[model samples]
Target: MAIAALQHLTDPRLAGRIVLKIGSSLLVDGAGCARADWLRSIAGEIADLRAGGQEVVIVSSGAIALGAAKLGLDKGGRATLADAQAAASVGQIALASLWSRSLGTHGLTAAQLLLTLEDLEDRRRYLNAASTLARLLENGAVPVINENDSVATQEIRFGDNDRLAARVAQAARADAVLLLSDVDGLFDRNPAEAGARLVPVVQGIDQSIRAMADGGSASGLGSGGMVSKLQAAEIAERAGIALAIVNGTHRAPIARAAGEGQGTLFLPRRRDGARKAWLGGRLRVKGVVRVDGGCAAALAEGGSVLAAGITAVEGAFERGDLVEIRDPADGALARGLAEYRAEECRALIGRRSAEQAAVLGYAPRAAVVHRDHMVML
Candidate 1:
């Protein structure tokens, strides 16, 4: 069956490439370590997807819990980064080994891939990561990815698997990302509090959505709470990838999210493709630049962002960071990701592309943002 068939059977918006993010809380029991039966169940669901000819990549988070169990750490205590790393070192091996064994029983193969922030941030590395996952799908082997916690320092840790899952979805060009956790879905307020209500769907990530977040709760095995889950959802939505935050404690949540049954489902924004959405949905921007009225009109007509139309620059950003491109005449014409850097374009501002070399002392690229990269809003 086609991948879209799964979505049509489940939810029309849910087919295509899928990434399942399994958090630590769902992977272990109170005593910690990989839960054998749970792993089996997960593997079985994965096998079903593979049999259906759908691609599935799992972003798993349980190395710390696995290591802690092996080393005997309690739930409430704090572990130094060293302690966490040491535990992850031991746990990651055991975790991958267990998954391999479990999947093997179902006549499936699992490939272990360890990643750090560096692997996703560098363009070459990002492409390499995408290529590796794509190859695994083609071979009918499930690619199981995990953050390399043992060696990751504070600076580059994915912090939680939620963000990691979103990044992976973008890299793999996934149709959806399923984040399996203890909660059934997002709530209007703390679910534990008496007044809270279950929010069936969220159309956009806005201030209203932000108000609903209450940090980590009962499932202490993982670091992310509803807030982080929403953050991950925002990432997926921007990439035109559907996302669902569902309770992982159930027998087959991943399968359910794929459309066989239950979970809190989210639809992607209908307006743009994955690449443009990524460029527009940045949480932090390095800089801002204003454009003249004529430039704004041209951009609205699907023209490239050019140096001659730039009126002002703000902030400092390097190549590829999401930026604000505003119309000097009015802010209404502003869109995101016009491409050229603040420093790089500052000198060429007000000068035609041909005169750019003589004025800036170097031959600069023609368009501030090539038409292909800039998505007009």
Candidate 2:
């Protein structure tokens, strides 16, 4: 229970890591492009956090908006998928330039990373992307992540950057996620509608809260709505990452949210490091390995999956890849970092670690899969 309580952030995770998402609505100036003063203020706040030893990554959504403004496209109407993608292609450069200039004022560098769902889906790419983001944070540079809007097709899209930010938080092993928007936080209903009120704290996700969310219709310059925000929160919560939704109208809202509790915070059910959280929360798996009920219990109780437990292995993959671990009777049990190559794992089924030398004629590593690299589903 205390671990669950820890999710709400009694003390700021300032010195810890965080992923901050800025919506298109929050980044646009009256002229309908990136706001320099607002960005400068945000960069200053981030600078302050970094000075205090905090690591931060920003997931910003404003490329399409800026692109539309620059190209003189219809500001109030929907764009075809092609139209939107083209705008994003042109806008991302300008957006990054603006952010770079602002961050330069604080003597900090911002690295632009454009990603799509494809990047997070493959094992090697997932590891590589996570490594890149981690190195940037460790080097004290702010990583600016955005949807690879220009090249992504329908099948590989992250519909909103909010959910992507949540995944980024998990990938970065961040302690918190801050979502900046035009409004302050989630309201009982649309705040623009009468009788709506802001709900300050959310303990868990429920249908009552889900019912209050609006649709994805953008108000001219922004794309996400309350629904995307809630979805993003759910993703973060499931990964044991705390989320805060705050108004971006004020300068340094992120710092204020962390220090003054000015935003609506959604707490997580548990605390997990990045690798475990990602392994546990991944929605898709490349392959499945079924084990007996005994093996499932061992894993649930914090034991490593042994070779004897593996009954079946499906899919073609190499060692150091991600594979799903399941109970033969009940199906999905957990996911782990595979130690043996897929073909080798199949050949070694029902064999012990000590038997590796006899079976393969070469002494192998001790574990079929190690607990340190695994997460129970």
Candidate 3:
């Protein structure tokens, strides 16, 4: 089984939709400039993948590094949020131009997308992003994605592109995620340590697996390290997407990683099983709604929760926030995204959908918790 899993990692044709995450350390030189030769080689690999009828998305990290270098802030010092943002603003243009020129050599168009954490957290924005990427893919354009660091503060930042790539994979419904890093693959311990061994296949992530990751960043120019990569793997696994971590210094790293088994492959759970697990997982429930017995029964029958059937609302929550549905007896029945804010939910409780506009001044949706968003416990 382990050998088969390794072979699956080496099969470049296994996935139709692929998300490649390039670390800053691999894309930037020690002097903090874009590695043009490396970019061109990777672009050539992408061209080959497209020729083979595969769609590719690139989640790259180098704006900050390039920006820092351009601004003379590459002296190995910690940069403030303002400095980082300034650097990102200056470097994003160069980064986009490099990717555009590299891919254009093979007659491919590169579409640049800048995103923040909120873009994926808000349901509406998430759908918008997904739709835009889908259209780009349909038109045969490679989406070159990067964090919106110019506007992101520490409180609202993704902190690393590794986690952002995982979110992108989920949003794009990618079949696999490839993380190109400085190391060859995941090691049982720090490779610098004596007797460290490579872990070729990972079926699950646990405390033991997490302990293997080093806390330090891979390079001075990058924010993520093995820890963030493991976090990314966990996110991808939950979405039933396979993730592979491999060395990026080699030529045609993507093809080699997929066709030579030169990395650690994290196996994904079955798609349906993963979805069910995600729905029932220990998500922080922000609010609770107590519904009538009729609504509880309807929920069990895969129906949405109607405002007229809700008897009470508890806790504060905004629209698109995860909330729990409970029976009149206060027993949990299901969980779903709230269509209305807590205050609006209070005003609309026990009211018909027609009365929503009168009470809230806007009738955005008819159901309090849409059936498509709700999951039975």
Query: What's the TM-score of each model vs. the native?
Result: 0.78, 0.72, 0.75
By lDDT: ranked, best first: 3, 2, 1
Tens-place lDDT digits, model 2, residues 1-377: 22232234333443278788998877876466677778888988888777776788999988988887777767521277787788888899998998898888899999999998878766578888999998988887899999998888777888788888988887787878888888778888878898888887898877898898877534556767888888888778878788888888887776666566676778776766756776665544567777877888898899988888888889987787788887867556678788888888888888877787798778877677789988765
Q: What is the alpha-carbon lDDT of model 3 when measured against the actual structure?
A: 0.83
Error of 1 at 169 (Å): 2.0
Clashes of each: 0, 0, 0
In model 2, where do residues sit more than 4 Å from their true spots? 1-15, 75-78, 258-260, 272-276, 283-377
Query: Of the pair 1 and 3, which is ahead by lDDT?
Result: 3
Q: Please, what are the lDDT tens digits per residue for candidate 3 over residues 215-271?
A: 777676789889989988877776778888899999888777767778898887545
Better of 1 and 3 by TM-score: 1
* Model 2, residue 342: C-alpha shift (Å): 20
How much does each candidate deviate from the true structure in C-alpha RMSD? Answer: 4.5, 6.1, 6.5
Please list all clashing residue pairs in model 1, or write none if there are none.
Answer: none
Model 1 misplacement above 4 A: 1-16, 72-78, 254-262, 271-316, 319-371, 375-377
Clashes of 1: 0
**lDDT values, one for every candidate:** 0.75, 0.78, 0.83
Show the lowest summed lDDT stretch of 10 residues, model 2.
1-10
